[model samples]
Target: MVAIALCAIGCQNLSLPSASTATTPVVIKLSGWGSDPTEQKLLKQVLKDFETQHPGIRVKYEVISDQYMDVIKTRLIGEAAPDVFYLDALEAPFLMSQNVLEPLDAYINSEFDLPDFEETLINSFKYDNHIYGLPKDYSTLTLFYNKQAFATAGLTSPPTTWDELLTYSKQLTVDKNQDGRIDQYGYGVIPELARQAYKIKAFGGQLVDENGYAAFASEAGLQGLQLVVDQYQKDRTSAQKSDVGTNSGSEMFGQSKVAMVIEGNWAIPYLKETFPQLDFATAEVPTINDKKGTMVFTVAYVMNKQSQHKAEAWELISYLTGKEGMEKWTATGFALPTRQSVAQKLGYEQDPVRSAFLAGVEYAMPWQAGKHPAAIMNNFDNQFVSALLGQQPLKQAMQRAQAEANKLIRAME
Candidate 1:
């Protein structure tokens, strides 16, 4: 009887038992951070549709508006976490290694068409041959360039290489008045590790050693980072958010403070809505060291191992990440679908603004650095910014960051 029930709930071909037949609907909780209002509305609709399909199950969705990870962690320690929750790729490594997540391999079967998902994304949630979560969607970084700025600068197309990007920056930067205070910079830079990880990898630098120790202070790493420092400090072609009195790269580009910025898919809608008059387009991140690279941000739906309604939780996870659910979720272009079939069906590759982001999926680096990612990321960002600002030598800053991160990782162990 138990085997039959499990199959009826998990196997798509098997008809689910009607609500009338069940004594009570099994209520399962789902939790994730708050997003755009439209995104939230779409999710609620998806959940409603899920309930309709499986009348025997009810979903109680909760939004953790701020400090999502911290709240989730506290709940997990108390065994009060939701049955299903969102886990980002960066945080996936730590949680997957902790043995608190349900290994989803048993629930997944051939009918799920697991092959449809992007390999890189699916692999992020896998540990020791057991799949812990299914990536719901992902985004890749791409160059967002202002078309008017390009035209005024007499440039025909977006930069195809880092060298070209730097050259274009110098040409695009302009000052309308005779004042020394420049009105615009060529590029807007986000000096955080998440944004610069691919740059490090461009020159064959590893973020961490096999033992999970920070290893980004190598010569290869410095070689790539030097490009950023030089562009900011020496050439003065790029401006950070603080420099331009903006909160984000999108804002800087929207205000015409920078002609170009490397940003993720989320910037598309924002730019369109906030700055309706601005004309912009996107291209794949320019190649560095003759290698194509960008960073990918992905989040997955993971199940709590301690959930009472394990089967129902699996049902919700499978449906949300399944092809049908993914299609509806990604139709608005808020996020790029992780499933290849869905992407093809949506025709995102042909989308002028999103095509570049789609093109980058093949070479994009997942924003993860082993189990102790926070230590590595926080330390690197702090030191890398100092280097970018000329407060310290790039080599010295990275070395100090690497040592400090390793020390923290050691303490965690």
Candidate 2:
């Protein structure tokens, strides 16, 4: 009777499942802004691969199509933010200072190879010696020129200096049909503070003071900006997107409304897929003030401090920003890899068109303003556009912009 009872107990134990096999998968909420369809598809595939490798964790990806930063900020305040999300470098300073993001230092292990990422990009997410985010990818501005336009203008090479670029612009501007209205402009200009930050730095001008106040109205700043103003108001060789009835600089260039434009890596896939017939080539942005300069824009994957599944969140971030995942993400050339190993493995430096962008990274200025970036960016862009339209003098416009931005920053404080 005792042996039969023991045998019955053993049979019951054998019928039950193990704890590990019966455990439910943790779901991580991941969020980012909407991108091109191809980029979105690639990201989805990466997530799928991550799930395949990590069957115990599933990522619930969400795309906030518009006002991404505003939505994220609101969600963070309500403690309803995703476990992991994308953060732009421009907005990193503010959020990193807010103590809402998880400091990733503890979660990172040596095998993760933090040193593999580009120093410039990685440093952007570091604040107070704590790494809050890991940069996923970066893009540096490059000058994109129409090859057919160059041939028509009898130009053998892209401009090597800003002066040469202006000269080339004059030659490329044309009134093809002689209808009195200009058919094509030489350059497409984006009169926004983000695109012009490097130009401001070209002449020792800065976007903000040591205390983070607006400081871009100095005499040195105007020198670099005057070049842009002169091209638009004085020479009339440059056209804003609105002037050409186009939506963006890339569109203006791709549609042949402008012969040249300064754009980033995203424009390459866009131009190729959208305007397949356009013959375009990219070159390092022409030197400004006899110094090499361009803007580097980067985005990082960050963790929410309030996440219930912190380990699962880090797993998603590490996998997405890891070498293997970065290689797969950047393989399409829609964006450049932030990891040096991935960049080397992909060989973007050897690519004929992409090489220009890669070369500019060494001298590129990260696209970050102070903690209060929107105030400075908005005021400067509004006034700069006014100056470009001859509505006001450059000096006065910038001065007004600087004062207004500083006033807003003070109010925020």
Candidate 3:
């Protein structure tokens, strides 16, 4: 569920000391996707601050360029894994089951404000009630509407229901040049596993049973996802995930090519910088029927169970994810803080631009986790796309995916 995108890097360029003897740099290695220039700078500064605060330990950061999983898996299998690496909600289950992640429950205990983090996000890292990680940053989904497009369609506020979404989309969509084809799409959705999974829940479907087995062939699941495909294939109001090339949902909405998009807090800065001419506003994601829900994803700094210097690792984890560090990192509005205290202190709960995302937290479900999460996703996405293209009925496509996922999961069991 936590599909980290590449943006907001370079926090600060604080220098870290090499693995040493007196300071006895018990190097704690951290791994994750590449970040934006600014985030990277800020992170480096944070690490340097960690080093200065705990002169007894040293921290190292590593990022994979390509085939990221393969690289991490190779290192892990060879026992060359990072002491602290990033884990997404979608990928956590598999890694945690393999005993790759250290359970943070004992470490977290009463010292940290565990209850202050978003409940939806906190539970994502829990397997069998054993906590494995602490969320460093978190975000929730919201509706981003292009104000000009809304005014052009004679609409004031964005829709709050599925039916209204369809109606507004039809009104906002247009063929500007009018040669023959449509120049602007009314709405769009990224058909990735994470986004589609959000849709599945919104429509009262669960991807897997409570026992952690596949169950996406259910009526609610298929109907939920079919809504997305039908809008594009039949209603002609939404664009295919790939139709916009490399432009993100925010980019498309900002260009006025799409009237509405369900995006997160991270895109606000990009929109302000890349498309300053566009007028936009954020609203809570529309309800499906009468239910209101969204997907929540998070990441945390976790210590390695196998590390000889856990005390040192916890020192960094504690500082970086603590109130002070989280507050500084979220100061630029790059991401929404997971802590309720940080969120309140930053006034994100009151800002209109962030209100919807903040509100979504109360109902947003965590992205699925556990062993076979990636495989489950890979198989579902392929069959889901086939269903979207009409090559197979929604039921059959999902059944096929469900069957395959069950087979894979059973083998592991």
Candidate 4:
């Protein structure tokens, strides 16, 4: 009887598991474009803290140093993409329509405080009433002017309107040398679609038609863009990076090649690190057409539709874009937090350099259009440069570019 009782007890013990055993942790991969070392360090720290909090998951962070979107698209096509990745607002429309990104609406819960995000920034990533991505951070184009240059030019403050800017540019443009070539230009012009989209919208011009085709060749569109063309071709007060032999507009401004440059927040850290002695101040972008307008750029954290561990992926996205994580990431001021609460907590609105950007968020237009922006942007840049160089009229250049863009758009559809 004792042996039978002992055997029964052993059988019962075998049916139960030990408390020490735990399920294996899931590994989720994340990808983003490479940034400065400081930015990269902050991201790694955030990831580490997340790992500590959620022991059941490990994150694999990867940086695609160059051609990020092209590489990410290729990976997605091959079914070997990361679980989560950064999606720029400019590219968001195209990617969202691809049906490759996981819709995040169902995963977001009340605790996430979804309403805390700036509606303008949030809407940039929304499509068809679905939240495809959550903006991590955003920046608006602000007028960054060289203080010393301003003083030398006998100016007291930054230009307040487009007309004032043109007047200011003439005074700011200087040729120190006896040679015909200019030494310092009044402004550094990007002359790209990403930077010029707002100008198109300023004159009641739409970037696309109701059917999502390029329509910026309209009379209203050319009216706004003509301002840029006049500034470059007729005013001759602005110089592009190629003309200045610099890699970027910010660099030209930092090197004193231009008195002013319309740049985003990323230039702040770069200018501070590369040209600490440069005395510069930022102000809200000048008004155009008696209306406030500036281009707002943002990137969001999006999940892959093919991710095997959807729950784990959502957890990572939630944490990274959450209040605490966003605060930590934006602490260094490398990027502006998308969360209004976080921005207030950080006091970026009061910071002199960042204040200008914060102020423009209200009136800024998001830098995105319909699904065929890639085609639209490419054609516009190619033709707009010709117009800027005086090779073609603004209206004619836009007309030709729009026709080509619509042709490509039709092909894609």
Each model's lDDT comes to 0.90, 0.90, 0.77, 0.89
How would you encode candidate 3's per-residue C-alpha lDDT over 1-413 as one tens digit per residue?
21111011112222333334564557678787787888888888878877787777777888765776667666665556677777777777766655655677766866688898888887778877888887888878888998888998899999999889989999988999988877788997777777777678766778878778887778887777888888978998998646866467877777777889888788898899888988999998888858887888788666555555666666677777788888877877888888899999999989989988989999887777345676578778899888787899878988898899888888766
Best-to-worst ranking by lDDT: 1, 2, 4, 3
Give per-model TM-scores: 0.94, 0.93, 0.90, 0.92
- Clashing residue pairs in candidate 1 are none
Model 4, residue 111: displacement in angstroms?
A: 1.6
Q: Name the candidate, 1 or 3, with the larger lDDT value.
A: 1
Better of 3 and 4 by TM-score: 4
| Global Cα lDDT for candidate 2 | 0.90
TM-score order of candidates, top first = 1, 2, 4, 3
Candidate 1 regions with alpha-carbon error over 4 angstroms: 1-21
Give the per-residue lDDT digits (tens) of candidate 2, residues 121-143. 99999999999999999999999
Q: Candidate 1 lDDT (Cα, whole model)?
A: 0.90
Q: After superposition, how far is residue 170 of candidate 3 from its true place, in Å?
A: 0.7
